[model samples]
Target chain A: MKAKAFAARLALALVAAGNAASVACAADFDWKKFQGKTVTFLANNNPVAQALLAHKADFEKLTGITLKVDGYQEQQMRQRLVTVMNARSDEVDVFMSLPSREGPQFAAAGWYADLTPMTKGAVAGDYDYAGLSQALLKAGTFDGKLTSMPMNIEGPILYYRTDILKKCGVEPPATIKDIEPAAKKLKACDANITPFVSRGLKPAIAYTFSNMLHNIGGNYIANGKSNLCSAKGKEALATYSGLLRDYGPPGVVNYSFQQISALYRSGRAAMSFESSNELRTVMDGGERLKDTALVPFPAGDAGQVPTAIGWGMAVSAHSKQPEAAWYFVQWATSPEIQKRMALQGIAPPRSAVANDPAYRKWIEEEPVRKQWQAALDVLAAKGSSEVGYPIVANPESREFIGQAVQDLILKQKTVDQACADADKGLDALIAQK
Target chain B: MSEAAATFTEDRQRLELAALSAPAVIFTVAMIAFPVVYTVWLGLHSFSSTGKQSFVGLANYSRLLADTEFWHGLWVTIALYVLSLVLQLVFGVWLALVLFHAKRLPGIVRSLFISPFMMPPVVAGMMWLVILDPSLGAANYILQSLGLPPSEWLASPVWVIPTVALIDTWQWTPYVALIVLGGLQSLPPSVYEAAQIDGASAFKTFQRITLPLLLPTIVTATILRSVDLLRFFDIIYITTQGGPGNASNTLNIYGFRVGFEFFNIGYASALMLTLTAIVFGAVLAFNRLRGAVAW
Candidate 1:
């Protein structure tokens, strides 16, 4: 009889403990009020979709709100959002934006609702929202107003083959100067292998080159003036051109990110500068590239800096249910949920989740994650904004810069001449406004 | 009384005729005329796709005059149109001639030859891109197997334009061939028979008889192909996207980039109007040429 009584008391105590934990996990706000409301969420291609899908049932059960998630390619999403925003339509309730380009433009246009009012008081204090990295949060801010929330923190990194480097008796390059010698040594070691490879074709080639340009203290445009004719800019262009002409694959002039990744993964190229997002693709189920390693983006004469580009979620100005949207945003970006996302190999934007013990265990086991963290560290120090020029508001800027790069690299035009020609054209375009 | 009744019936008949044609005329005006008028109006102003508009009056046109990219695109369009048209016509007429003389298994063979025209332009471009891909494309693989130097068909700036032209030719030549074949089959068989009876050799008969009789059909095919090829977009967009430094960008691609991609609607409108005028002029010139030939 005494033992039975003790057992019952222990059972009740355990049940109470479980109830208390569940209560703590539940959001402080009244989720029932949002019942019957439908929310549309838009995102660029990110793995967060899977996590949202996984927890969607729980959210619906708690709030009785239906969530519809839509994903688009980065550029397409940007164009769509711009069209809708410019038209002042409520077609999208929430949208994914990149800090460097879309955030500033959208914020300037007042397309994003100011979230400072929504994120204050009891709700803000209930959540551990303070753990977001200060630098990343600052990037998302525009003129002292918080417009968007960061989803994943990402920057460029050097992807290399460990086996190949070992065979060549060389280490991965730590700086821009080291790259050439390492490439030469690797080339000498293996004639069949491309020493270094990068995307040097039209349009997207400029994106890869921009990272290097930023590291070398080169600016595309500065102080409301075109600065492509600067000495640093010229040297950056020459270095990029020389790398492609001398060390890159034979037909790399027409390559893009996909082609560069393919070359590196296929063991045809020794190393490349690529994004962390491509890590999953490179390391998945391929014997040839399973041993790939990631490192910080090489340092330039100015310093080691990688240009950070990432997509973040922002509530549209047209949303009818700002409160409900906030609830979903809070849920999605919460430390608990972000930790879950990290376990599933998705890069969470929250600093707390990124440094969590559970998340670190998984990251340590994966070579790609180690590289990603290394790249992130370098980015934290020397990373610059992806925004080059406000004149790039027009999409033709991408094409114009891309053509200039092609002219300098493939057509052998002097950097000054090429940039001057491009500047002249872009000036005309901007002047038309 | 009889004269009044006759006049009333005649007036009623004229009214009926007018009423019968009203819907067709109204439909054309609404669908076609309104947009053309709107494009012209929009062309006169500096309109943005973002709903920002200002009256720029002839400034867009002036810009077009100084625009090097526009001029480059215009020349590329001309080169593509002329090259593709000439090659397609030559190959098309040759194929028509061969098919006209064919007998057994000719129908099957002709269907197979013209099958490329049945595929959509996007699909056709994708097929060609794969076949011509520098790295793993079947074309390069076969070249390697045959111990020949591999050519960077799409990568080389010098060859990129010609390569795109070749793709256009490959896909469209069959369309011209089919049209020309229809025309050839419709020709009176007795003309050739008469030439044969007159002791004319095959080549002489072809040059003297078939050539003269096929002039109208050839002219029609030329006009049709030229107009369509001038507006070429899909193949170029899919294959090279006008790249390796804008080597294949025609006026259509340029307008699309400006109007849609860059949101410069006013400039794009002006560019479109210029393209339309060029097309219209070419058609008029070709019609005049055909009239002289017929006379």
Candidate 2:
């Protein structure tokens, strides 16, 4: 009987030790904890996504989680994300976002997960939370809600043809006051070429036009009323539309970023105003890249302020596996990955990547890249976050602003009439609870 | 046969027929009736994209009535329906006459002519996107070479609807032609024979006899085509996305944007139901017109 009792006690002790070891293992950080689980990431077909997809195996190996990415064009991707989220589905655990445009609407609708806890808690030590730009982080935040993590900061900048500008004996403008005169000189240099090209499509034009509006010291909304008819507002509208209307290409009325990029690349436009992120596309060839130069939007009476926006990776509130999703987000937005993406033409949201040795060296050696980076640096530091009205009905609100711009360009309505009509519409939209 | 035995056999046959068709009946109800009932039910309630719903008692309908875009979209829908119908019918009948009278054409040639009708509408739109590209399109190149001014076909706000209408006509006219061709081929030979005997010219005979007899077929074809035209979304969407600033916003595109893009489910439902009513009302009016016209 004594021998049997001793044997039982020894067995019990051994089992307890084994259980304690297992508990210790669980407490330690283990990437493989979510092994064999699957995550679906909905991505837009952008430079960041392309780089992420190219290196997806690294993530899967680190986490042992199967990753499936459904990539779509930007517009289609947003529409799909809205549909999936509005259905309150957990099918998609992680997705890409342009927080500047949709942050308020999405956060208000409770479509995005509040990431503050994760940012400060367990994932804090693994992820360098301070590495990202505070401005970009604030852009991703809405009404005290931290909904997304910033990835890239992009805004419209001037891309001018050096050969054309030089032949015309005109120097680059340091302010908006100089653009009109320079445009005339360039137009005189070559009648066959358009002097300027920019997005004229409604809603889309509002994006680039906001930069112009900012330059002249105008605001879209103030104190819950439309401020588009302010003296500076009229100046911004008339200036932007007048540039395109007077010296633009024949079909400039319908031009957006795609057409504007094509025009500049085709050597049809001497100067193009487009997104800073379009370096890869605008710099299509080595020779063209050499001739091309990027400059900050010229300063106006107020100052040189451009409108900038940020794209981010976000977890859905209804995610079935929030931890696994965050692991993927953190791993993707880490310093090393961001540096890699920046070298490949995506504007980095993290200061670490911007200060990385290799990225800085590449910018120093590459002439076209040097100019583009200079423009990005200025805009990143000074750009305004309110590209359009930040409202739940943001898409609807843009139409009012765009219509005014469109009417100005098409010569269909007077500036006063356009603003008044748009004001009525905007006032009504603002009245919505 | 005895009366009792005969009655029993008839009843057994009836039961067997019902048994054979039961699957089809069930399928029709599942596919068609259920969705329609659900759509109507949804139209009566205010709903969010996340499936949140509240009864609002015709508020959505009243809102649409007050909305200017709704009325504008309806006007645009009617304009497209009428314009495309006219172009398709005219070109369709003309092409049918040519194909019907010309027997020497090779089978390959006829097949090539019918190819556009076989192409998907979205595919056709994309193909035209290349052909109508303002900078590098063959259409503009040819025009410039011919010493003519190049037109901004799809880009121009004033020309988008008409250009889209023309593209639609190019695609669907063949379908209308095939239908009218069948009607022409099936016509009684005696009428033409009588006209020839009376020394009537070919044009006169076609107008007096062939057209009079073919009116019913043409009317039927127009009604069918008009129904399709009122719901036109794919080509316009694939081409312009109702752009250059709401210039080409059609009823179908408007409703889709409201429902899917804007995520206002109740308003979208009301828009679609109104569109459906428009389609049904148009068919009823056209049928009445057909009845009034004597063949």
Candidate 3:
């Protein structure tokens, strides 16, 4: 009888806590005051936009503000954001940007308003805002100032054919050494299959190459200089080049991410390194790849792990309504909205939401979900920030490096010669700057 | 007093001539002169895409001099120009000769031959890209069925320039052929018939009469193709984007990359000015050649 009474008191306390949190969340904002204001959002044309549109009406009902979203291709969106920010035009209130390329530049230039003050004290605690995955939050911050809020968390994972592995009587490789043997075995089993594939062309291939280079403990620039000639960096390049030359399909040098994904999906490739975002496309649209398995990128000798590029939302510095923009940003990135997005296969940046019972259930329902979650965990644990190469961010660097890589792969120039030539070009660029 | 009146009448006549050419002068000044002057001015300064600029004297030009990529791109441009021009002329003349003798289904044949010219360059590029795809493309498929090794046509460094040339030729050869055909049709039949009566063979008549008369038309086509191919960007941009490894990059694509992608507008403008001078010199040389041909 005493145990039952204690349980009753515990249940009453939990109810009171939930009620108090809800009331606090409800009291923080006056939605009716901003009824007539229109909040424009610049979004990329991806799955996230459709998920946002589904929740659009709910946001409007809650805040009494009209939500207008404009979707553009990733590059087009980047160009438009830069144009608007540089011109200080009020074309967009909230903009979506990836952390690797545009985020640092935009933040350093004071193109995004500081959100540190808006998120403060008990109000912050009531929402699950504090649970944002650390790496994403860190990426969004510059010099200890919050410049942006993450919309989704993504990282690279190894995608493989479960049926192919079974047919070959081999397990999925967990380390780099195991990959070659497994590839050979799989190839022996099927003469038509390419063991692996990646983007080999310039600019398009640079992103994957950079990630792998970092995974093997290489840096684009070291101590304020180009490090392409470093021992580890050269080794990384050699490994990447050898993989494509030896294991890839005939036209692998010309393949981009889309082609790589298509090869894997069409059952032409045994395995590939691809982003988690491509999971839906491969599984849902690709009937042949429906039974595919996702795994963390095979570990290198140095135990290096690669991270996926993630997107974040930053309030424009020129926003006419800073307070209102912050309000919407806070609402959108809140635990409630993030959980909703997670249902649509978007990995929420908040670990709490990602670890929620409902989210776990959703993952359990899909064969590839566990692998993506596992990869995320691995990346979270081992992935380090990419070393800042002052010149790498320049568009010219992309062209120079892209050409050099292509030349090396096509055997037009030795790797050493190509790197040396590229270094000179980069040095000239740096000098001009 | 009568001589003075005559001098005034001459002055009035000169004024009337100036009035007649004023529109042309104004149009050239507005469209061409202003842009060239502005580009030169921009070339001498440090300008970025975000409207950030400062006067830098000849710094942009000096930078261009040191840019190896620019030089490489120039070579690619010239190689593409020469290759495409030669192929277009050879194939174009061959087609024109064949069509000149066509006595049946001439209209339908001409339309079929001219169809490629009607498609936009970008669309044509995309179509060729699909056709040349190494794995799924029909070209490789046929080659493989013939018991041949698959070739990376677009992806190979050595093959990219020639591949792009092929695409350009496929689209523009018909245009040149049509122009040459028009030239062939307008030629008097009497010249050829007179040669035939004198026991001169078809080849000899073509070599003597047709060749001599077609010199002006050939020069006109060469001039047009040279200018058009010098600034070649669209097909290359759409097809390989100056890859694999800058093998297909032309002067215009290089300038675009420098200006927009690098955000170094001043240096790009300098490159443009240099290209303009080169193109102008080529046109002048072509004009001299045309004059020689006329003589």
For residues A64-155, write the lDDT of model 3, one tens digit per residue.
88888878867567667766876788878988876665555566557878878766522434465568777877877877888888887776
Tens-digit per-residue lDDT, A113-217, candidate 2: 888877754452435678787888888887787888877778999999888888889898778878888898888888877898888877687788889998888
Task: List the pairs of residues colliding in candidate 3.
Answer: A155-A308
Q: In model 3 chain B, which range of ten residues has the least summed lDDT?
A: B44-53
DockQ of each: 0.36, 0.33, 0.32
Cα lDDT computed for each candidate against the true fold: 0.76, 0.82, 0.76
Q: Kindly report which residue stretches of model 2 are placed more than 4 angstroms away from their true locations once superposed.
A: A1-27, A122-126, A361-365, B1-24, B47-53, B130-141, B193-199, B287-295
- Per residue, candidate 1 scores C-alpha lDDT tens digits across A100-155 of 66465467567788777665532533456667656677888887888777666666
lDDT of 3 by residue, B1-295 (tens): 6999999999999999999999999998899889888889989888653346799999988888888778998899899999999999999888888887876756877789879989999799888877887866788989999999887888777888888888889888988888888889988899888998999987888899998888778887888888888988888877777777777778898897676555566888899999988888888898888888762
Residue A363 error for model 3, in Å?
Answer: 3.9
| Chain A TM per candidate, in order of listing | 0.86, 0.91, 0.87
Q: What is the TM-score of each candidate against the true structure?
A: 0.85, 0.89, 0.82
| Model 2 Cα shift for residue B255 (angstroms) | 2.2
Interface RMSD of 3: 3.2
Tell me model 1's lDDT, rounded to 2 decimals.
0.76
